[model samples]
Target: MSGDDSLRAVFARHRVRLLLAVVLLLLTMLAGVGLLGLSGGFLTAAALAGALGAGTTFNFFSPSAGIRALTFVRIVSRYFEKLVGHDATLRIARDLRVWFFRRALPLAPARLGGTRTGELLARLMSDIGEVDGLLVRAVGPLLALAGIALASIAVAAAIHWPAAVALLLLLLLIGIGVPLLAVHSGDAGEAERARHRTRLRTLAYEGLEGAADLAALDARDAWRARVDGAARQLAGDDHRRRGRLIAGNVLHSACAGLGLLAMLWLALSAFQDGRVTAPLAAALVFLTVALLEVAAGCGLAWQALQSARISAGRLQAIVEQPPSVSDPAHPRPVPASPATLSFEQVVFAWPGESRRVLDGIDLQIRPGERIAIGGDSGCGKTTLSALLLRLWDPQAGAVRWGGVDLREVAQDDWHRHVAWLPQGAPVFAGSIADNLRLGQPQADEARLWAVLEQVRLGDWARRQGGLSAWVGENGATMSAGQARRLAMARALLRDAPLMVLDEPTEGLDVDTAEALLVDMAAALGPRSLLMITHGHLPDGVVHRQYRLQRGRLLEVGGEAQG
Candidate 1:
């Protein structure tokens, strides 16, 4: 999507709250100007009286009451404006995060494989920080400044046309012209900031991933140097941007000073010619300077606009990425009963690779059959299973379920009916029950225990506080074997008709692996199983075995072994 389109979408989502905030902000600005005008009138009235008469006849109560009331309104309006605007900005930030995450979900294990954990975290968090200024700093201030400028010009014109014209010209020069100049002048600084961000992200991710290695090798100094270098680059970029911002501010101040001088000259000329009263002239001059605050506010808001533009471009890139796998327009329902799986001359390849991973592979398995696929690493065993799960569509041929192409079924439906235990299953930082609940959100304690029993983890779980036991970050507090077994329990709890096991026992002890396999076969009786294994199969378990070699699947003994 284009940058403007993306920003419009964000605005559409936030427009209602933004409009309310802007309206309140305009009211606040109006009240502030009224307060300033009344105070100036009060001062001029006090100045006009002779010493004894000023002390006795100055109508202090009237102007004091008006000033007090207007000040109260301004304060209240300002408070609500900030409250509503900041709340709305936070809401937009949350929605953008959800939108980005949902869009990136289906592209995982392939599209997301190359991204580091730290970098992705930064994008989801820090990138959103940059975009927050769009609503918080840019929108409300610009709207308020526009209102103040127009109102000030109208008031000035009613008093003297020359003062009004000068004020408008100065506002245009500072608020519009200088900002455009700053944007052009700061382009190099912005580019440098982008580069600095990339370097920081890369270094942060590398340091996180290599923390253990760096500690072991006493290389903390080297990593610190790299981090410091990235930080210095970011600092330098910020310094340049600030320099440009200061230049813009200086230009704005100069224009405001010139406008004030013109307003003073016009007021004095009108006073000398007896075309205006002294109090009127004084009010116009004071109001003219007060309105300069509006111009400076707009200048600061413009910088926020520039930052938002940069962040919007980055966010748009992710949102506009097309999904590699999307549901069909007219999705077919998955079969109610368990169904046979068929791969007919299926061919597949990695995203950017020229060579296909699976070439002309044809296979069929009856319902409730247990099929074991054995192969060396990178020989298409996992690729075939991923295709069955519809992670990616085959470049040639089709994978069918119950005589219907898998692609015809809704993606959600297909996933719902099949449970996949991927290699090194992720263990979130939560209790054991929390981890298991991902597979079966509604599973009760009894049901959880049953699945744990099936996975041979029931006794162990009962000893570890049942389902409430904490599993530390990435299951770090648990051994590799325990984490794997916990993942197995989760898959068992899913209770889907088909189970795809990918290296389920890779890191388990021989006894533990055999026990898991035995229990899995018993629990999954009469359920279709497509298991990927690199070890010797248990005796009297798998009904058939297929070996993948050089991207081709071959029967073990020239017969269906079932």
Candidate 2:
């Protein structure tokens, strides 16, 4: 489904609350009209009774009681309407963010890597907000507005037909025509405002993320200028959009005044001609007033609808992009046994490039074997691991697990057979245990401590108050070497047959890196290890070493010393 359809699906999940909000809004609007019309008629009747010497057949108590009832209904219904509507909108926003992640997370590095972080974030944070609030703030209220307009016209006709005709024409103009004008004039402005907003967010995000680089290069001033310019453009678009909105308000107000005068003229004529009582004629006028006042909000609601549509389309564009790779039509499961991984004559290139990154690559890792592959940056060592991980299929060959082609196996099941430690693995804002659980959610404390000890972080965890201690965002509280070890420990926690570690010893001192590899090699009991790095390894860490350069892998001599 398209993103717009998905957005509607999110709203549909809260349909009961949305419908209730509409009903409450309708009741609130109807009560307002009823209150005013009732008051107007009662006042006219009382004045007439006053001139008739105060002994007339006027039931003042009943009209007074009705006025109080409508007043209470309006206040209570509107309060609950706001409460339910806002609650539902918040729920939808929460669901939408989750849905966005579910769809976009799989595309990471392969598809979404080309996208700007700020632009992607703008869609998640800004665009989704526009869609999530539409049902509550605009669609429901507009529906209720229509309901009240129809009911008001019916009441006007019952009192006097000509007045109803006049009221209907004016109500249509106020409800439909004014909103159309607002949307027509403001469409371009709305789109421009959205672009400027996204641009501003992108600039702000880049400026902050690259603040250190900008400061070092003396370019912070230029980045700030770009942000300010984007902000000014956003502000300008907003001003123009609101200016169009004011035009709609003015048009509605004019129709309202004209509707009031027309109703009054018709009502007074009918009463003089003995067609309606003074009280009923007065009610018709007040009813027109109440309905038009409510209808005055239609322009803003319509504008919101247009803005939400633009935002939804933006969200849809991203969510609907085809993944670089897809699962097979009939994916088979990996065999539940000790699996041997092999790359057979694999040829590969990036998505939009002609140059091969892995050209006719071939390797094998038997169960419980330790193998290390080393290469310079951009030499496709990581690409080799990626193929084994099934992030992308080889253009010309097959990656096999226990003689079953990796493409034949479902990605999730294949992933379960291998544990990955990517170069840029994240340490999320969580406890050490929480971070470790990503690799092994059901791992016991003893196991967690064991893996931490394996990665040379056990003593550090103990000093930091144990597993439950807070780790700052992106492991901000820890040094680079500590965070790197934490990520390694996470991968180590997974009980997979194959472990792929890309530059595993990164950010550690020379002694620490070699020592960590030694412990990792010792800890590998019957598990095959494929470690990728350009750094020198301690002797006896791996059974063999291979070199990758210019898209070819060849058996190499010794460690690549830093």
**Residue 147 CA error for candidate 1 (Å)?**
1.0
lDDT scores in order: 0.81, 0.86
Name the regions of candidate 1 deviating beyond 4 angstroms. Answer: 1-10, 51-62, 185-188, 191-195, 213-221, 507-515, 557-562
Prediction RMSDs, each to the true structure: 3.4, 3.3
What lDDT score is found at residue 150 in candidate 1?
93
Q: What is the lDDT of candidate 2?
A: 0.86
Give the Å error, residue 221, model 1.
4.3
For candidate 1, write residues 1-562 as lDDT tens digits. 4344454676687788989999988888888877777788678877776544735566779889988998899999999989998899888887778767766776776567666666666667666777776776886788777888898889889987877888788778877888777767564566568657867987888898788899999998999998999999898888878887888888878877887888889888998999887767888888876777656766567877777667666666655666667798999999876788899989898888988899888888788898899989999998898899898899999999899998898888999989899988889999999999999999999998888887777888888888899889889778777788889888878888888999989878887788778777888867789999987778766888889887788787864322
What TM value does model 2 have?
A: 0.92
What pairs collide in candidate 1?
Answer: none
lDDT of 2 at 331: 93
Candidate 2 structure quality by residue, lDDT tens digits, 1-562: 5455475677788899989989999999999999999999999999999999856889889999999999999999999989988888898889989878877888876778788999998998889989888976689878998898788878888889898789888977888887897678566677788889999999999898889899999998888999999999998888888888898898778778877888889999999999999999999988887887788779889988999999988887787788767888999989875868888889999988999998888888888889999888998988888788877789998988889998887888788878899986899998999999999999999999999888788889999999999899889889877888888788878988889999988777898788778877877778899999999989999998999877888778643322
